[model samples]
Target chain A: MPNEAVQYLLTSQRDDGGWGPYPTLPSRTESTALAALALRLAADVEVGARASATSGARWLTETQLDSGAWALGDGVPGPNWSTTLATLALTHFEGEDGAAAAGGAWVLGARGQGPNLWSRALGLFLRPSDTVELDPDLKGWPWVQGTASWVEPTSYALLSLKRLRLVGPAADTRAHIDEAERMLLDRQCDDGGWNYGNSRVFGDVLTSYPDTTSLALLALADRRGEPAVTAALEALPGLAADNDSTLAMGLVAVALATLGGDPEPIRARLRNQLSTWDGGDIRGLAWAAIGLLDGSDPLGLLDG
Target chain B: MVSRRRFLQAGAGAVAATSMACRGRPDPWTPEAAKKPANSPVAILGAPDYDETRLVEVVRQGLGICGISARNLRVVLKPNLVEFDPQGVINTHPTLVAAAIEAFRLEGAREVVVAEGSGHRRDSQYLLTASGLQEQLDDMGAHYVDLNHDRVRRTVLKSSFTDLGELYLPETVLDADLFVSMPKLKTHHWAGATLSMKNLFGIVPGAVYGWPKNPLHWAGIDGSIIDINAALSGRRFNIIDGIVGMEGNGPIQGVAKQVGVLVFGEDPVAVDATGARLMSIDPWKLRYLEATDAFLGNVGEDRIEARGESLSSFRANFDVVTAFEETKVEPSTGGAGGPARIDK
Candidate 1:
């Protein structure tokens, strides 16, 4: 099944050596990075996987902006959150090249803006019930600059920074990692899973979504022994079942597999679904492959 | 009527006085729009429920009354596919969307694309499937574009509603000859009412704006609404699904209230004003519509000509959250009520 998924990715790769979110759309940074990572992981057993991964890596490297971030691949301007994913992909394929380090530097420099004085004052003036209950001053990664922090991009940044740390010690990486970790922990929902941004909004305790919760848990895999992480992991099967999305199920399987929890049931479900999958969504296929592959921590999400 | 430039200057003056503390306000660039007489017409047609056959007839009739023609034009239907709700109140009903697709195609549209960038969720496939739109699209063989990841072109904001000078909006929307906003008529906790104009927020690419569109949230919801509508003025039309609406705490998390009507118009402001009126909300109380009334379109009852059914026939008071209590319209006494000029 993993081989078939890899074949789909290889067939779907554009002439520019990247993959798109869907087969018909132009290649994007996030989809390309995920596909490249999955391909590299399968390079050992799958034929032609290593060369395809290199081509994808080459596209990523060549398209790297002067600021060290990759613009969103479809001509949208960036230095956006996709930089984190590109960094992780580059680090995995090329082992800490200039492209990876520059991505780290850009990520470190890119922080979600803290609340302005006016907003902060407004927050102070408003009742707690009227506002989201999280520290706006604690900066995490935003999808783009000059906006508030969100969960998924922040998780990707933490993962990228962790991988970059192994190349050599950058003085600022640890602090960024620590702050991002705090940010993720701070935004965890009441139900033990994670939301896209805040756990609460305007007094409502928002529920968690499977994809976001899985990504956050994967990024926090090293802290698996903690109560919060363990509780979140324990809640995975339910979340996966409830969501039952290709991306959600794939991510949950990867998260569970990375944390030493049995992902067999979820994997079984994904395998069943993938049997009739159209291979249209490259990102979902890549994640499915990474989750269904016979290995723990195939993308080194846990190793970092 | 104030021009968009004059409105901007006044707003800039307000900003200056407040030491850069004011939110983005209206623009003053379109003199043509300002000079145009406020004869905006909105059609309110009754639709009892989600029967696609009946909805198609009602929608086609509404389109006819509104003088809309789809001859060889590329149409993009931007619906409120915000999130999944089991009770089916959060999003525009898929049956209504299917009806619109059929209506436009019957009107000779060359292409009709259903597009949405969901605010809360990033995975649009899950949203499409959960919202029952995937099956609908497949059955109809219609095209669906996830505007979140669509190719974008950087567009300058026509009005300064947000600090974001320009936004990377999806080309699918920008390229459409007739860009229709198909939104569920619902009460928004922040905006007081979510209708056609508010639904334009989904056109902003998530690739650029992020999930939930926090950038617009930061910029001021009312101002961003005005800005987005102003930028895409001439190409826009709206058909709101008011047959079933969410009344409390929505855009998401609200109780379903069946309003039994479909709203249609070319002027988004007028359409929304009619929508608010049907919901028993005073459009004048909504800041976005008020600001928009200045240059965008008519919000006054006397200024707009109602087509099809009378406003009183479908009017019902929708429940709103605590913050928007003042927005509810007081029930009329024995008076000269209803749209000033009702068309047969």
Candidate 2:
């Protein structure tokens, strides 16, 4: 990891011992978790770096709700989308086992059972066109409960579960992971990328976005032999080449490296991109650090 | 059983008798009748096309009708910069935003800032650059604040439609003297249609609500719209871009339909209603508009006065997807409130 990126992540930490998406924004769980994981992955035992990660992990553990989910903030809703990232960050610390386990259980229980019968009925009647095929019944994760499942939240949850080995030798855990995998595959766009969630809405095919595609690919790295995964891999290079988004570029690089594809070109491109970055964006800096780790399993608790 | 001439004669006689009886007495319903006058006026100007120069004049004329005076007002033009699509009319046109800034500046407004918290993407810089709004703002020397990362203050909702009793809105939204909502007139798969009122969804900070502002979605799209608009109350005005609007399934991912007009009004509900009329959808059918009629603005045609171009001249049948067609509410019978629909 570049020293400058690491330093940026450390300095951008809010006085509350959390990090926000950008320097000026209030600290958020997702940004704080990603930043903490990046620092832990750097594996520099220096006092300043270790303290930063510990403080961030502590914040995540403390802010966790009684239900083990972390709502977005004090007044937002349930920490539905943020729990996975927070759980992954907590696994980096030694005393956070209980919080991590509770969060993991909460995340496991949060899978959306798709829309109910009434909603499905409404959908069938209200859908603009039937040209695009999708099964709303496929159980997957939603960013929030009672809403339709989307790709990014599902992918991040899967990545956390897999990294923590929370999907243990139990049958239900295995089944849950298998269902989530199916859901991710089902949501993949025909053009080999993923959108927010649905492959199509109405008659129009929603365009696949680079950030969502990269996150989905990163979560499904072990299943690259699957046809959908292979197609996604084929589709990623062009997106990475064309995308100027720092976060997208970094995530794509990490995903590509994890999939045993060449990372050198992406790494070089990212380095060039980071050269122009001022590091005020803590989220981008965190992703850039993780990408620069070059195949290191930052979120994997057992890797070390 | 009566002849037509005899029926007309009887009706006239009854009216004359009632008028004679009420002549020296004040009618009990007079106060209520006086209170509920005609609906607010919404300006629908014909621009023919997206001529930047012509758009400036059209916007100026529309604002004039809407009673917007720029002198010494801190104006914030909140445009919908949801996402960028080079071939699609997804975001508000940069030319229109630029024109609004120029119009406000020419009116001697103290300040005009272009603001939006993009619900779909977190990277405001990228969205601004890709949407062409950044260059427009830069060229016009107008400030552009990403509401997603802007400093926010939590405001208690005393009469919220949603379960959420409070919202953390950006300081810019709360501080602006004149908050102008500039939404691209488009059809939405979920909300039926997204006009000025639906566009206010972008005002909620993404940092608090999460990208795509899922919390608002969970709170119920229609209800959330009511809640946010109610919070902003009297400070809001609307300017809708109907020059090249989206149809079918939209908000994103839809075909562009050019309607060649700009709709503006101080009442967001009325302006959106006018835009909906031009799109050939009944405003009374939209639940958010229906629910917010009394508090926000009335959607009733009898209440609204039209300015500039006539509605019939620019009306086009916007193709609503079958899914959102379920959102269409039947016209309501006159009651205490305006139109009402059971929540879906």
Candidate 3:
């Protein structure tokens, strides 16, 4: 019954695994995507964990509203947050795509532009079953845990494709990365953090915030060996009051350590600060719990 | 036994420095909860006796000098700005909000900003903008922050609800010396009626966990509400707006009937006790009553010192919005046209 937290999160699944109400739960998208991501983390922890994760993905697959579109509650099933997040959760499951055809049916049936979170996410996941084809600009989309309004949604769609290494032409990837990196580089807080500015879904309420900084840290850690990442790593210590905020910062700590960036002391410091969020809170708790468990001792997930 | 032993061992630092995050305590209503008998007095706050003007006065006077003053305090009025629209009684009304601002101002208040991290979809910003909150604040010369868009400071402070203090509140509210929550007396699906004590949860910054607004049902009401109530230590003040109380199912989708009464007090529990009594409900019986119910706040009918009019004076029968009844009421939408209004 106390799994009520997980239940509430799962109840949020769309016909796709992705989520949004935009900025938070009930607005919908972030919860679904993060839950999907959380499910992925739990699944990766144990083999059947992925099966537990798939229930949500299946919900997305089953709930693929008739008209071949998806939404949070009931609206025109446009290819926005819900459609895209659902696509990500369903396709990225740990198992083979036994339900791929059914999922693909819903994806192909989708209306609206073919470049939204749904369309872009689909292009990355379900393809010709050959090469990972992607639109050039899609590579540099902001990979935020939550949507970042126009820049973030587009940026996330673009980056999700890049993470899959599915970019079509390398030139487009460069352009996308350059654009996203420029946007990211300029917006870095003095403490090497980032937050929602005018481009935030929650209004202008997120300055001096750690959540966005964590996303940016994830992005930088993905490029851990880079100079920009070095600067971001340098800024993390100044921002730390404790460990929950350290997921993004911790990832960078490991990335920096791996890069031989004077990280031993910093890694230990952030590691001590971080706690196991394996319990419940937000979608990031799903990912961070896995990361923390893996960090303590490699259970062999994505971080390893 | 091993898990409990392990839990005790691992919980060393939990008691030390924790934040204002919801602890994952087993909800009392969970199937697992029946194992332990839920024994506790349900706190009740009956409606006050005073008229509208006096209701405000009595609450301020009741506040007295609880070791705080208006001139020195950076007073922040956090009304239930959950979502922008006032039409739905789920949020604090602009009238009550303005009155609190005015009252705080009378107490020689320095600043009063009515803020919230409303969970409404933001693509509907044009719609939210029409909530008339901005205009009200603009006219009143007060700051209106979409906590969704406000600056926040994250810390892991100590809390009774959870061991790790969970995630502390954002500095926007945490920084203020005093936080006065003016919540509407409405029926809550999870918490029954979201009175004074329950409304303070809005002050928790959503950014630390990544969501802009707290997902009410995420932990149902226990983790969210209990942790919120437990985090506040200072003598908090709550003024319940029951002139038109929401009944049945509420906080959002309830019908507002004229229950013309204002309830207020220093202790959120005491004030809410008055509110529940006014609604003809026993505070102990309400669903989301756990967090504050345990506080020494519950005042039984015999013991409760009532100053204003009693619940007997007004027996107005009002049908509140008990559940989600879909109306044609689309918020001020963008490309989406507004749902046809019934009044027109």
Candidate 4:
């Protein structure tokens, strides 16, 4: 099944050496990064994985913005959210250390400064809700600069930084990573899983999503024994148990495996799910492959 | 009360006159022609209920008035699938999406694809299932495209509202012969209201823009709306799902405010302006509408020819959040510097 998934990903790669969310879409950095990471992790289990991963790494290095970050692609402005994934993919391969370091530095510097005093003060009176319990002062990585921090992007940043070992070695870097972790913890809903950003808004408790919850937990993988982590893990089943989302299922499998929990069920489910996938969804195939690869840290590849 | 026959006759005359005015131009429906009172006829039908059969008829009639003949055209219906809440009407009703698909098919559409890139959540499958849109799409045998993950083309903007000069629009959006803005009329906390123009935010894929498409928000919501509206100038139409709307704080996180009416028009600005009026919001007060008034078509009530139901007959004051209500600008006086902000 992993071999088939890898073949799907390899075949799905465009002539540009990048993959898109779907086979029909143009090659995007996000899908390409995910595909590269999956192919790298599955090299031992499948043939041609190494070759595909090399081409993907080349695409990442070529597309890196002068600012040391990757844009969303096709001139969509930014050194934005896709940067972390691109950085991680580049760092996994040989001879790309220079590009990887620059990308890593950009990710570390991308932490958004929490909204200004005026914005915060105005928020107090704007649609005041009893259901939401988030602190306005906690800062994390935003999808873009000068916007409220969201869980998924923040988690990706954390995962990438941790993989690069940039979480320490400098006072400011450590502080930034610490604050981001705090922000993630602070935004957890009463229901135990995380939403996109706001836990509650205007007295309505926002529903927790499986993909977000899985990503948040994956970022906090080292702290699986913490009370919050335990609570989130317990709450995850309710959110994700019956979920047919390939993205969510893949993330959950990786997160559970990292936390020393049984990922077999999720791995099996994802494997079965991918069998029916008509080879168009590159993201799903990439995630499914990464999730099913046993005892492999796709994010931690080449870190040590 | 304008009769349907009279409205169609007037529309035909305007089309002919515009065709003569721009003889060599590729598109006869120029901005000047679209703004003419005879051209921009908005259909405001009294749905009074969410009955699928009745709503389908309303969509058929409204699309007809707007001159949306679907023969051989690949139509894309962009519904407000921003978030899903079974208990709350956060998304466009699945019944409405189904009705539109059926109506288009009956009108001889080559293909009618239902697409949305939900801003609030990346899990589109969950949203599709939770909102019951999946079931409807399945029953109708319609294809659903997650616009956020679709192939993209870098499009240069002719008019930029924010610092961004270019945007990566989904290939699906660019491939369509006709793009229908099927938005749920609601009060937006940041932008005053999420109608036709605001709903276009979903067309920007999350694969590029991030969930909630934060880049656009950072670029300034009003400016991005104006920019996207300008980019999608021609081949754009608006059919607002006003039958059940969210008010007070919306796009997500608002209580349902049932307006029980379906609003439709060829001119997105005029349709949205009329929608704002139905919600008791002054269209001139919205920053985006005010800024793009010249080229985007008229938001003024005087420029739009109302058909079917009257505005006053279905008027409901949707509760605007304090933040948006505070940002309201005074009506434009045809002066320099655009509409001025009245000191509250």
Best by lDDT: 1
lDDT of 4 by residue, A1-304 (tens): 4456787888888899888777876777888999998898887788999988988888888999899999876556667688888877766777877887788888877776565432343353233463246766677888776666889889988777776773223224667778888999988988888988877776667778777887888888767799998888888767878787677788787777776667787878777877776654577677777778878455562234
| Candidate that scores best on DockQ | 1
Model 1 agreement with the true structure over A133-249: per-residue lDDT tens digits: 777667789987887888998998888888777655654677778888888998888889987887776677888888888888988988998998988888778777756567888
For model 3 the local lDDT of residue A127 reads 43
Ranked candidates (lDDT, high to low): 1, 4, 2, 3
Q: Assess the local accuracy of residue A233 in candidate 3 as a C-alpha lDDT between 0 and 100.
A: 58
lDDT of 4 by residue, B5-36 (tens): 12112221334434443464332123433332
lDDT of 3 by residue, B235-315 (tens): 356667776677654555566666766665555655665566566555544423423433334434433456545455644
DockQ scores for all the models shown?
0.45, 0.21, 0.02, 0.34
Which run of 10 residues does model 1 chain B get worst, by summed lDDT?
Answer: B334-343
Better of 2 and 4 by TM-score: 4
Window of ten residues with lowest summed lDDT in model 3 chain A? A197-206
Q: CA shift at A77, candidate 2, in angstroms?
A: 7.2
Model 1 alpha-carbon drift over 4 Å, by segment = A117-126, B1-27, B30-37, B333-344
Cα deviation at B18, candidate 1, in Å, is 6.2
Report lDDT per candidate.
0.81, 0.73, 0.45, 0.75
| Best of the candidates, TM-score | 1
The positional error of residue B172 in candidate 3, measured at the CA in angstroms, is 2.1
The Cα error of candidate 1 at residue B166, in Å, is 1.7
Backbone N/Cα/C clashes per model: 3, 10, 46, 3
